[model samples]
Target: MVVGLTGGIGSGKTTVAKLFKNFDTVAVYIADIEAKKLMNSSNVIRTKLIKEFGKETYQDNQLNRPYLANVVFNDKEKLHVLNSIVHPEVRKHFQEFVQLHIKKAYIIYESAILFESNSQQQFNFVISVYVDLEERIKRILERDNSTKQEVLNRINNQWKEDKKLLLSNYVINNYSLQETSNSVENIHNILTQKACSIL
Candidate 1:
């Protein structure tokens, strides 16, 4: 079973994914990390990105992440173009990862833009991780070398936390680590049972 896990920037989505991995039966496929790998390693993606964004899209045969981030973070159209080039490859790679973990009870497909990409229907279950706006901004500012406005710009690009929470099968209010860990453990048990029943 494929379980979709998503949260806004600075909502600790990656941290939650790591906690899920603590369970022996859970496997996770992090789309953003894989997309970066594809952007750098895939000739097809590299060619398309360079053609669309110009030569500075890559430097020294590696993705110029800062340059591209500066470009797309402010422009919706360019961001759409970048996602178009990378998402298909990430989905394809995720399929292979899913097959590799077929023996596991369920696998978590972690994407920061799960709802924005309109891919939630592809999963058997969907989980949304959430924190308030101020908390998210504070977290992002501390974690990334980003200005508050830049963090806000990125947050503006995603669906609001409330909307994602309403659409999700499970919601994790991640205000504290111990609470978040408990939520994960509980949900992991639920998913295991749910998957077994489906079989």
Candidate 2:
């Protein structure tokens, strides 16, 4: 089974994904991490990004993330173009990763933009991690060393949490680590049972 896990900025989706890793039968594929790798390693992506945003997109053969982030977050059209170039590659990589974990009970594809990109249809189930906006802003500010306005700009780019919850098969409130872990454990058990029955 393919499950898509998603949440807004600072919603602790990555932490919940790590908790899911504790389950032996579950495999997790993180789209953002893989996308970063592709951006740095894939010549096609490197060329396209540089062409779109200019040579500063990379420096010393590494992705100049701050520059790219500044360009994209400031312009919705630029961010959309960037996603248009990158998401297809990420989806292809995700498919290959899923194939490698074919025998696992289920694999989770964790993406921040799963719903925004309309990629939720690729999953057998969709899970959205939620956190209150103030807490989310606090977390992002600390973790990213970003200003409140900058963090809010990123948050504004994403679909609202309530909209995501409406589309999700399961919703995990991730204010506390213990509570998030418990929710992941419950979901893991349910997915494993469902996958086993299907087999």
Candidate 3:
């Protein structure tokens, strides 16, 4: 079974994913991290990105993240182009990772834009982590050292929490770590049962 786990910036999705990792039957695949690896290592991705964003897209054979961010972060069309190049490869990598973990009860694919990319349909279940906008902004500012406007801009690009909640099979209000862990534990048990029945 594949579970799509998603949340907006600073919604504690990563922390919840880590909590899920504590369960023996579950495997976790972080899409953003894998996409970064693909962007840096995949020859096809390198060629395509260089063609679109020029040589500055990479420097010394390494991804120039700041340059890429400057190019895409503020431009919706450019961001879409970048995602077009990266998401397909990430999906392929995700399928391979799932196949390798076939013995596991289920796998969680953690992505910040699962719903935005219309990829939630690929999963057996979708989980959304929710936090208040003020809290989310504060968290992002602290974690990313980003300006308020910058963080807001990124947040604006994502689907609203209310809309995501309407689509998610499960919702975790992640204001507190202990509470979040408890939610993860409950969901983990539910997914394990579902996985057993499916298998």
Order the numbered candidates by TM-score, best leading.
1, 3, 2
TM-score of 2: 0.98
- Residue 164 local lDDT, model 2: 96
Candidate 3 stretches greater than 4 Å from native: none
Q: What TM-score does each of the candidates earn?
A: 0.99, 0.98, 0.98
Question: How well does model 3 score by local distance difference test?
Answer: 0.93
Off by over 4 Å in 1: none
Q: Per-residue lDDT for 1-199 in model 3, tens only?
A: 9999999989999999999888888899999999999999999999999999999999988999989987888998998999999999999999999999999999999999999899989999999999999999999988996899889888988899999999999999998898998899899989999999998
Better-scoring candidate (lDDT), 1 or 2? 1
lDDT of each: 0.94, 0.92, 0.93
* lDDT score for residue 138 of model 1: 95
**Candidate 3 backbone collisions, by pair:** none
Task: Give one clash count per candidate, in the order shown.
Answer: 0, 0, 0
Which order, best to worst by lDDT?
Answer: 1, 3, 2
